[model samples]
Target: MTASLEAKAGIRRHAPAASRHAYVTLVTNDDYARGATALTHSLRHSGTQADIIVLHTPALGEASREALAALGCRLVEADLLPLSDAFNARHARRALHGAAPFTKGRKPDFHTPLDNFVKLRLWQLVEYESCIFVDADAIVLKNIDRLFAYPEFSAAPNVYESLRDFQRLNSGVFVARPALATFAAMQERLDVADAFWPRTDQTFLQTFFPQWHGLPVTFNMLQYVWFTMPDLWDWKSIQVLHFQYEKPWETNHPKSEVLMPLIALWQAFHDGGPIPDIAALPGPSGPAAALSPSAGA
Candidate 1:
């Protein structure tokens, strides 16, 4: 931030988008928009100098878009599903999200689940040398600039003990090079894959990069431990706290006691001050809450 436009223009020439590094995420609907905003706010609060990028579908409302823009994030909107016969049947509506072995409320069943795959579009950020993707439903407790030093392809293990597990390489937080060639490769692979196993972008990525480096658990310490075994919770060392279905916005749920404290941190970033009591999100309001288009497109 300098006063001289000529100096700034010179700087921009040196720091073209090709040399940029960023943190990326996505929001296909209003439900996750709030979380994405919090994520951006937290990154800025952590003093990151690199770009904070978000890939969203056109369905996102102006409020959510403005919220992200307010954090100095670069929001790139794109049409995720292209009109082509090359599409994979695995991504078809019925096969989307794969087998729902989890409880009813654990995952989305509608077209909402389909847009989750759009995260793969991250590779299209060809201008970036490398980018770290963090799921919107997460909290960045501290600066994680260290991730930028790791390999172009790296991620923390999922909430599991064995790396061999399908979900062990969590897609929630990862570092990767962004290139058009790689993006095309991913698109081609998706077109040919029988199905996105376990039904998500993580599975597709696991298939593509078998030798990806594994980052330490501190980078993506999940909150699952707190919910399953409250006594064993270790709050001090966490770099990121990921909340899935029952995110911070859903405040009226029965887990208010467990959620409020965690939600407080996100509120602190969102409000730009002391964290207030978290509350349930009201029904979608005004044009910002327009009915989202089907992802089948």
Candidate 2:
């Protein structure tokens, strides 16, 4: 059977099963493939009993697929949502970036705004009773199996800058219940005439589930918190470390110097090197620390 059909059947066959939760992430290209690898490694390091699933688009390369499979991640090939041509054109990288430029930090060249929509496919994964979707650029620092018990639409508030930012939900890491009904409802509302989502899936999801449950920021800790709100930087408390704007894999990106320590942590996971005790890492310091509170104020 085809993937879509299999997904549908899996939902029917497995939805009623108890404790069938999975950790899901998306991989749109080779760069994110590398990120997903580190993420999966970290999940294993965290000793999670849940299954690891990598939902990848066709853009991901074979070598990257092999790496994820070798690490025991179940690969699910996901297709982009069939939105209108106008919607796709509007959200195309060039047009979207021109209209709403990212000024806070640099986004890597490999970033594609449109590809992010593929994350909606998570709702189609009805086979798993619950799934926690973590962005490929993030690494699990702690076993978050307890998140499966959180309600369907639980997510961390997008609180990198200030307390007010809590109004917005960050899609980087979230708990979801897989059901065909939810997926169908999303499709019906996703692509309307002149419809546009500035932040792609992140925007649509926040709108679709306006009353989304708030997961603690520790569950999806944005890297900016290191510098923007150093007081929130508690290694022991962070369950997931998200590299939001600039990726840790990039060489000499704009924020590279400030993010080096976190990048080093990611490298150790990616390179299969000796994993360091996160609590032992030095707390935030330097000019970056000086720039916060005001920026977030």
Candidate 3:
């Protein structure tokens, strides 16, 4: 059966609520395949018992699909045709002169084109009683069974603090329960707000939750040296370590040395060599001489 039909059958056979809180990831592009695999491996390695699913947009060609399938993951092809209007940044952000009643006091707006598709996937998958959304760029360092216990709309602080007034929360990780009313309100705000904030999904999310009730800073730790000094976080105690910037594929980031195991695995796959022992990674040297885009530092 096609993926859609299979998904429908599964949904009917086992209700989302029956599974309660599940964990899901969005990997809309083929380039993100390695990150997706690492995410799944790290999660299972740490003993997460929740359902794990990856949402794929049509752009992921056959090779990408096979690679993901080889990892024994469930895939859902997103309904991109219906979102054609929103898929294109220009049209989606065009100001509508004829204001729809629901858009009162709001202006024509859609978020930056980069990860709006991810926002859509989050909408579709979080219909369960609770759900945890983890960015494909993240790795699970520890078993965070306690994360599921956080209340709806819980997330860690965006270490960067780029947004004003509100402590910007990282969209990279969040724990949410079914809050149909809240989700609807947040979605509407995103669909019609004026183009004034950062062109990032995290900016939209920062506005979604009120300050006092937002999740504590301990949950989703954003790991970027430039955003804040890396030493600020108790790295050993973090629930999720997000490689939010200078990602592994980008080559020669100073912080890449810390995640050498992940970096080396990626290098082995690209070089067609035997996997190197994660422990014996060459002592952080000047960027590898033949720096391929795939060998991000």
Candidate 1: segments with Cα more than 4 A from true spot: 1-19, 83-98, 108-111, 160-167, 229-232, 251-254, 275-297
Candidate 1, poorest ten consecutive residues by summed lDDT: 6-15
Report the lDDT of model 1 for residue 250.
69
lDDT of each: 0.65, 0.85, 0.55
Tens digits of per-residue lDDT for model 2 on 1-297? 454676543321212223389998989999999899899889999998888888888788999888888888888777677778899999999999888887777788999999998888888877788999999999999889999999979999998888999889999999999988998898899998888888889999999999999988999899999888889898888999999998988876666666778899999999877899998787786453344333432
Off by over 4 Å in 3: 1-18, 80-112, 160-166, 179-183, 211-218, 226-228, 251-297
- Candidate 3 lands at a TM-score of 0.66
Most accurate candidate by TM-score: 2
Give candidate 2 regions above 4 Å deviation.
Answer: 1-19, 286-297
Q: Pick the candidate with the highest lDDT.
A: 2
Minimum summed lDDT over a 10-residue window in model 2 is located at 9-18
In candidate 1, which residue pairs get closer than 3 Å at backbone N, Cα or C atoms, i.e. clash?
Answer: 158-168
Residue 40 of model 1: what lDDT?
A: 80
- Model 2, global lDDT: 0.85
Give the candidates in order of TM-score, highest first: 2, 1, 3
Model 3: how far residue 233 lies from native, Å: 4.1
Task: Write the residue-wise lDDT of candidate 1 on 1-297 in tens digits.
Answer: 232642322211112352378888888777688888788877876788888887787788888878777767787775655524424454555555444443422443313655767787787667777788998888687789878778867987775323354346888899988776887787777655344455467777878898889877668866544444344345555677776555666645434444455666667776667533223322123232223332011
Candidate 1 lDDT score at position 215: 78
Q: Please estimate how well model 1 matches the true structure, expressed as its whole-model Cα lDDT.
A: 0.65
Candidate 3 achieves a global lDDT of 0.55
